[model samples]
Target: MALMQSKSKILIAGGGIAGLATALTLHRLGLKSITVLEQANSLRLTGACLTIWDNGWRALDAMGVGDTLRREHTQLQRIDTLSTTSGLTKCIDLQHHEMRLVQRKKLLVALAQALPSNTIRFGLKISAIHQRQDRSSIVTLEDGTQISPKVIIGCDGVNSTVAKWLGFGPPNLAGRSVFQGLGNFPQGHHFQPKTLEIWGNGITAAFGPCNETDVFWYLSRKSLSSDAEISYNSTILQEKARHLAEDLGNKEMVEVIKRSTPNSLSLTSMKYRYLWPFIAGKAQKGNVTVVGDAMHPMTPELGQGGALALEDSVTLGKCLAEVDLEKPAEIEAALKKYVEHRKGRAFEIGVQSSVSGILQSGSWWLPKLIRDKVVFNRLSPKMLHHTGYDCGPLQILS
Candidate 1:
């Protein structure tokens, strides 16, 4: 049987954080004929956890889910950074803002639940995209079904097919990878409500309580050039993580790694694609655009990947709300503004994250000395505060 023909005012690809948040924000702005297509059979609960800072909380509050998330997450009071080489620890105050550690699954659930039933369609994958002269998109699904929506927003992640079709290239490897896991303590564990990071030769480890009984942790190291074959086996990855934790000399982190099951461990190579070249080289074509990892996939050093996705969703919704969808010129102009604003912000964050990963993973004596002696002590708080931007509420553009 052939798939039935359908149309929507807005089609959002990838029902992850960015897509779901976009749908919610648009609905709040009185635009409800939105459909989100997710390739996965169901919502993905795969990731370990996320560190949502003040900016993310502001976005969530604008979407009306801030209180809901606040009740579920463990609010962090401060961030503690340790240097194994110098045996020094530095604490940066969060100023009582909303810096939270939440399970990825919970965050996804909250975003999904806020939307109306039937807002998202699962197991539908887009294979190709064609933009019309009138600033709309004709999308071809993997099963050969076609959809023509007035607007197409790609939230499909780092390897987004929509982004590829829109002329943006694939994400670049940052020459580093991470192994992450969650440790569950049913009887509860004795750990302060803070985010802890430890850096040493060639490796970095971080852990924090996600809730009363669970702690999220990750270990990152430089990939062996670009030629080394990295193993993805669960047991081997777990073993590698255990050894890295041991090298960090943090008893709490080591114990957390040991307590985690092999199944909870996962490895991912970091990759990013800067947005400036796409904007400068080619004018954004038609009404097709991307958000979140699809647009700007950055290193996790700054923990702004997810937060930025939330920011994108709200901003995109506001921009689109300002125009009359019936007028192609107005719609095009609104999208241009959105792209101009997001591209600048994403590029800055991407560069900052890349540099931070390099400095944190530096093994050289001079770089390590500067990072430990000056950067961590004098500049850490300033860097952290820079991410505290408030994404304002969605509004009608005058």
Candidate 2:
């Protein structure tokens, strides 16, 4: 099925934050016709806390609604790194950078409401996409419906079928499960409320204000078994709580774990592909382009998984919008320029996420000290090249 108009039809696969934001960003650039095929009947955002840093907030400002997010979210000013035992504050004044923490559901709702109701096609699962030699691609749904699109973006996330069909498969699993939960302040005991991160000897834990009353918390541990096989049994989750209670040593961590039902806990790990476009020895197919987790998956270590996705979507849209839809080479050239601008930077962020993961999940004494003492002290907001410095997008249409 084609959109019937010559105004370059794009078949965006997945309606998550990444996909939705891509559609909206492209629409804003005057590229109107788009079809978002989401597998689920309704939107499902993994319930957890997502901290959109100043880098991400700046990009949102380019999208023209960073303030809308800021108004609804809790402004995070400080992230105190605490001791594993007794929960003593180790690093108290590490320059609280401007960050916004929001619940995943609320963020998704905002995206859904911003886009037209008809633009998103619910219950459409993409089984495969046939990429042609002429640089055009056709997407196929599990229902056998075919869509000939000028551009196809695989924003379907970590387990992306679009990527596999285009000859790229899942990246290596990093052997961890990022468990998350949301709960209100326990009755009769005032919650020690602050936007804080507690660094244990082996692992780290983070809890922050979701709104004003509720809180969101998350931790990632080396999964003994694959995440797919991890048992989500109530008793099993309680055991995990029991294990963590000693390390976290905070009232909120104990209360949230004890109070949160098993069904509410969100768990998953991070993964990524080797950088190919900017750096050699990795593979990246053109036209059948991938974004977000599909292109560059990352651990929650730095919380740039969503931020990178948003950046990729905007940059991809900007590049494609500048190309000549009638000329295949011209469009390819624009995409190539985009690949040059983003590929290296995206891969570096992936490395950064993994490094943070190692520091959080490892129990070694000297290595942990190096991360906290040597590494953390040397780390400055100015040192974040990926976040602070970003080329908005190339205007190469002319």
Candidate 3:
């Protein structure tokens, strides 16, 4: 079978946050020829929830979907941390910055709803891509169909085939792994609208409410066991997470973990690309470019993964809007400008998130001392500084 629309002006790989956001941004700019290719049969909502900060909301506002999402969850006003060893507690006020914990499915649905119908083609996997003599790229699908597009954006995520084809190195493991899931309270849990974190030896745990009835949580540990060792069973993983919380003496979190279903549970090691690729290599080749985790994959310490991807959409949208896609040279130039503007910022955030992962997941005395004594006292302010970034507006050139 052949694809009815064999060609597109703009093609985006991956229908997750990055791909959808890029498509929505272009739609907001009045571009009608954008197409998003998702490898999954339906939307991939594996990650149960996401923490969208102020910067992410700004990008959402630019795409005209911020207010719609804001109506679903309350704004988190503070972050509370507990050190298990010293039994010391710290609180950071977030009265100035906006933060919310939202269901991942809802976010994906919202982005998809805002776009034109058929803009996303599900289950179309790209097997290979090569540049044509005319500067366009020819993408070969898994079933042997080929589609040529004037512009190609790789938003396929950390294991991006597009990134590998562009000559980027593999992602590096951060010597730690994480378990994430969502817990439902049918009777309505009454927890305050604040993020709570527990810091234990080589382990960090956090949780917050997604709405009145559901809560999201995660556990990160320095020691990693192979998936086979952990049994690859959600029930077992959920039990393991509950056990870790029990060891940390968080009875509430243990209950939360027990209430979560197997479908919501996930476990994976943290991975990030070294800064050298961004410093020396090209994120944009010919009329092609990469966005979000496809370009820079960072640990979840800073909670900026989703936010940064949103920022990329707005930034890339602005760059592409300034040029005529019909001209291959113009498209290439626009992509280059987008890469120049984003590489430095993404690299800086990736490095900072790595540093934060070390501080939060370290078991040694030195890291614990610094974290409890110095870092906690000013954690929120420093976070505010990083999340305060503005990716500008989405506008097109005449």
Candidate 4:
């Protein structure tokens, strides 16, 4: 194949939630020449569901997909927590918060559909990244084609190669692993639209309704083995998830795990980066920068992974919209503004999520006490406070 020099003004890696949203945000800003490179042949739609809060919806709405999504997923009304060891149950009302359990596929499709059909190029892998003195970047695809773009945004997720080239360390293992899947009850699930959580004995399992027939569920516990040792086979993952659900003695959750489609089951280690590096280190180098999990991978205990990425897309787009991308210095400055705006917010949420993960998986008595007594009631208010933050609306740049 001949060397294809990309004429696009901006190139985004990973085409996942963060990448798609960023491209959509820029498109909404009347910005053109944005190209998104997705490493997969198509969208990866098998992951567990996302719990998008009001802040996420705000960003989605700004991107013009909020109402489209709200129509598909049920709005969660409350959180019901049960302790397997203590046999205690608590309810946290969420009638006021606009939260929904969204299927990952649906969200990605919505974002992807909103953009121009040619915006995303799938099945192309980046083999190398070279930074230029002018702050532009040359991205080499595995096929040997080279594309030099004025700005490169890395939303490639936790194992982001763009982030690695930017000098970021690997994401730290949270010392815990998660087994998650979607359960389908073709007839009807009949459960109220609420989040049901159960914890104790170093395990946390939660499930919420995506619709009347589809339920998203997950079980998290202290890591039983190293990240590499964890099995990726769907059958093995399903078997382990079912076993854990049985041990928790939740017959309903057990049934959910059993009912899960084999393809939907996944087992992986939870990883996050410390806030120090983001604060003290560089989030951007030249015209290249990272966003979403590439920038701040946090535990799902806070359920902010998807939401935070949505927040990052809007923030980054807004920053770039105000700059004159023709100037390399201006492009770098725009990235710097985005990094500065997001690092502090990302750090705050990252700390809370890490602490929540620790409390959820800690087998020690003191941690258990706090998880049961302090976390349940206080968790909602804290979550609401964070989710209430608005990333502001996008503007159309001339």
Candidate 5:
């Protein structure tokens, strides 16, 4: 109905993991005027859980929340992979790394709590964004209220309107979909602190304990159609998952599915956008840019989606801290530095994830044989180590 002015200098869209983390990182760098807008009525408590590798922990440590997360999670010592088609199995030692499994909501809550009160505004969906010649952005909300902020960060996810407005197209689907659930064992279940995955023809399933009493699990398969519809009814989805697991013939996985509550099941399609053309072309238009899935959506083969988002938050914060935001040219230079530092790493991971997904999910004989004999047993550990990059420190200006 009327234009509203914001005192905040930076406006972040999509108050999910990346957006909230960005706000916290900026606040830690002594920038207090940060606003996070979320379309949801409140924080989303739905998603099952997330596995944070060493690199992700480093980001959390920079934010000062790593210790809090470690207290509630189950540390992983190893990862075991089993191929049903070839009847081969391999185990890779994680070796003193801080890999932990945490509930998604808990992680979000921890990030949100560290920020100043009222930093996030729920139910404020951004409708459009227009960047001025001087590198400031005018953001319009769905309610027709306009606010001009010094910078606009797009952490809105794969279907990001900010990305679209910045000239990045929708992500490409990986031709597969995933069903995930949280298996609750109120009385506690006997699962070792290790990640386990079973690969079958055209299907794969993974399960790992998040804590002493609860486990997080997922099943992925080729989509029935190009545009497969997701079933949201908990009972129906649970039944579908159970049947899929039973068909895979993994008794352990079946038991985990059965233990899960019907309401905790969720189905989502995988999508990603290649980072080369986007980065080589234009990642920042004036003062508006994107991060996390909005900028580099990739398949979850490496489980780095959330981790990379965390890294982006801290890295962007560091870059912005070195510049004078009041000067448009300085702001543009800082964004360029952010893109130069992040694009290569993010693109490498995206391409690796896409290739890994294709190989891991292949039903062909030769690919399966090579994957079982070479990839899992030999190459995977090295790949895991490659992702453990440090995003550097979040520096505060004096």
Candidate 6:
């Protein structure tokens, strides 16, 4: 076995939330030899929306992205439920604990602006990864150039190529798929800036403020069956979505859907997996470990994918502070430490989020009523836990 003397040298794949956060974490810990290889020539975050709860916001602040996110956010006004069938506003929850809504592209841009230039390689695809006895992984880029580092982090997301090369792949479809899109409401956003999950008989609609004039909305139901794939750069999606909302709201919403551009992308929501142990068949476990959706893919019910990645980055960075990375074995040990500390909590969140999706997407006029009346009541103690999660660069349990 051979080794390098650099204090901590890391390689991260994917440029999404988890990979970027991990890079930020490594930097904060005084490790500058971190390299991020993104398949895209440059990160192109679309006009998609995202939530920054106190926990997520805290992660951005820790990474020095607080001001950026604040600038990008549409300060949440309220989250509530309304009946399309009855056309009545039932409950309203303004800000349980100050949440910010920002377009997904803007958030990604802010993260990019915070990182050092050249640390990220645009258009560089990872073709394969070779793990050695020295505990370092040699990442082969599409160009046949192999870059060796002390460890590798997989933040490549659910369709992770690295995970696939390491003998892992996307989990089976979980039975439900989600439809997501943004629309222009000339009549004004009926729901508050806060996220609103409206219940109905056998169906519900969740809408929230994405920006001043736009709202990010998602609807999910049972998938009929596996069929074929379709591209979104056309008007077909918006047409399909109109039927979803015609039963509720008003002509204003329908008008919005009619005008929706072809840029909207749909998500298949049911597939999921837990970050059990990073010891995938041939994976080299050094300072490397997976984070965020790559490690713990799940339904978006909990809305903590980015939040959890931020926590993972911070906690792992802090762990690096105390461990001597000069020894390859130490880095490997730190990865184990990361899994031991995070697996249980992350898995629990994924499971709960998945179940929560099922619970929220339940059928019936009566069952939905009971669930909303009990669960959506903002003043309950459980509601507090639901909205209030810790801001962390949490310590890694060694």
Model 3, C-alpha of 355: deviation from truth (Å): 0.4
Runs off by more than 4 Å, candidate 4: 1-6, 226-230, 377-383, 396-398
Tens digits of per-residue lDDT for model 2, 1-398: 44422433777889988888778777767676777888999888656567787667766666655677777776755566665633345433324456666767777777777676577888988887676787577667898877776677788887778766656646778877666777665443343435667777666777776666666777766776645554455566555744675566677676666655455576666566655533541223556666777777778778788888778777887888888666767666766666666777787888888887787667777667766666666655554456564537433221
- In the range 1-398, model 6's lDDT, one tens digit per residue, is 12222322677888887888778767765776777778887786754565667777777777777787786557776666665444456444454566776667777777777777777877877788777776577777787777777678888888777767655556657676676767766666565566666655545567666666677776666664531243343355555657776765545556656655446545454678644444332232554567776677777776776677777777667666666767877787777777666666677778778766665666765546646665554433245364455545533221
lDDT per residue for candidate 5 within 1-398, as digits (tens), equals 23226487788999999999888898989885788999998998787877788889999989888899898898988889888877888887788677777788889999999988888898898899877766678889998889887788999999998989988877888888888998989999889999898888888889999998888999988876632455667776777888989988878778888888766678888899967666684677888888899989999888888899999999889888888878878877888888788888888889888888888888878778778777866745766775569997666442
Pairs of residues clashing in candidate 6:
40-123, 48-104, 78-94, 78-194
Q: Which candidate do you rate higher for TM-score, 5 or 6?
A: 5
Per-residue lDDT value at 344 in model 1: 76
**TM-score of model 1 (CA atoms):** 0.93
- Estimate TM-scores for all models: 0.93, 0.87, 0.96, 0.95, 0.95, 0.84
Instruction: Output the TM-score of candidate 6.
Output: 0.84
lDDT winner between candidates 4 and 6: 4
Off by over 4 Å in 1: 1-5, 224-232, 261-264, 278-283, 395-398
Model 2 lDDT at residue 32: 62
Model 3, runs deviating above 4 Å? 1-6, 228-231, 396-398
* lDDT against the true structure, each candidate: 0.82, 0.68, 0.87, 0.86, 0.84, 0.65
Residue ranges of candidate 5 with Cα displaced over 4 Å: 1-4, 226-230, 396-398
RMSD of 3: 1.9
After TM-score superposition, the amount by which residue 28's alpha carbon in candidate 6 deviates from its true location, in angstroms, is 3.0
Better-scoring candidate (TM-score), 1 or 4: 4
